[model samples]
Target: MNRPSLTWKLYIGAFYLFLFAPLLVVAVFAFNASPFPSPPWRGFTLEWFTGSGSIAGKPGVLVDPIWLESIGNSFRVAIPVALLAVLLGTVNAWVLERAEFRGKTFVAMMMLWPLVIPGVVLGISILAFFSRVANGLEDWLQTDLDFLRPGLPLVVLGQLSFILTIATLIIAARLRKFDRSLEEAAFDLGASRARVLRTVTLPFLKPALIGAGLVALLMSFENFNTTLMLVGSVAPLPITMYGQMREGASPAINAVSLLLMLGVGGIASVFALTSKAER
Candidate 1:
């Protein structure tokens, strides 16, 4: 095999450094013993990662409760969103790929509109629509509808509006290469449609489904604009971090960011390694 030229090697190294340098800095500061979360590190300590109480020197930090609750809230919203998005997206992909219908192009374009639309706008629209519907319901039914409040369900709805598009695209791409003959053969052999989908179709789409779910989960977790607008009283992790930063810069925020980055990176690495092994 021909070796890469010196110039190409330098470019690749530079590209990786550019991508990873900020993350490296954040990780380093997460362990920094200095009161300030920035440069001029005095020493190294793992207190940030271990402490279960409030952040040192910050009374209102509520590091344990706020951060932990936010993390839970994020997952609570994200997991359901990802699952629902995948189920709906997979069905949409199957229909679009297998069936010839009028206005198919129009339906496809509408499904993709969420990706292009700004998150802020989408959030605002959803909030407005829901608020109107909730008010109508309260007036008509004379009962409070708590689900419309800014919380897990609202976050999931906001996220699913866009995430479903991603899942649809990924699963649809995989479906394009699927052989219809397998399903036909299964039918001829008296296998049920559901059995064929469970045994044959889903296995082929597993990688894409996993990848899409991961993407949806990460996106839901890190989402700021939409979550900010849709979330009423409860705060997710990103919003909490932003509020903390706005109030006053703290190393604890950096520490949390670093830990989250590590968690996400670890998951991605495991997925990659497992995928490679399977191949």
Candidate 2:
């Protein structure tokens, strides 16, 4: 391969720095001794990361009651939602990529609709759909299911609406390049369809499945708009942090922000590296 010009290499380096400088600033401020998150560095301090103000001897955001509660709630919503979204997405990808059926194009298009739709619109639509469906079901079945009301469940569904679509596309991209003859060969060799899938197809799809799952999980954890609309009483980390910011949050928020940036950045980096390796 021909070496890139010095200008091109410099531009790539500059682009990366441009992208990551702000993140570096936030991570640095997380340890800033100052009360504010911005510049005017005030000596280093671990208090934000690990020190209980007044609560049980525990320390840091991990110990704060509100932060802990919100984090727990976020995990509660994110984990199951990720699992369910991945399951549905993997199945959808398989069906769309491998199956030949009437209206498959239409079905695939509908599956991808959420990707193009605005998150706010998707949230509002989900809320409306939940209400309408619940009302109709209550009328027909004569049972009022209060769980259908906006809350964590609704937030999960709202996030799932688009997250699943993303996961489907990610997995489908890998699936489209897959060789179908492998599955056929396995089947011809007396392997059951389930066995072929388990031993051949699933293993080949593992990286994409994992990448899509991590993406979905991260998206669910940090979701704001869709979760905001569907959340009734339960507050996830993002929503809680948003409220705190509105009230003029303290430096603790910087600590949280730094952690989130590191986490999301790490996930993205790993996915990118693995993708490059696969290619």
Please, what are the lDDT tens digits per residue for candidate 1 over residues 177-234? 8889988998999999899989988988888788777777888888888888898787
TM-score of 2: 0.87
- Model 1, which residues run further than 4 Å from truth? 1-15, 52-55, 58-63, 273-279
Clashing pairs in 2: 51-60
Query: lDDT per residue, candidate 2, 1-279, as tens digits?
Result: 498999999999999999989878767887877666777887888888777764313357866788889988999999988899879988999889878999999998899788888888989998998899999999999998776888888889899988998999999999998899999999999999789999999988888888888899899989998898888888999999999899874778878888788788898998887787668
| Model 2 poorest 10 in a row by lDDT | 54-63
Name the 10 consecutive residues with the lowest summed lDDT in model 1: 53-62
The lDDT per prediction is 0.82, 0.86
RMSD of each: 2.9, 3.3
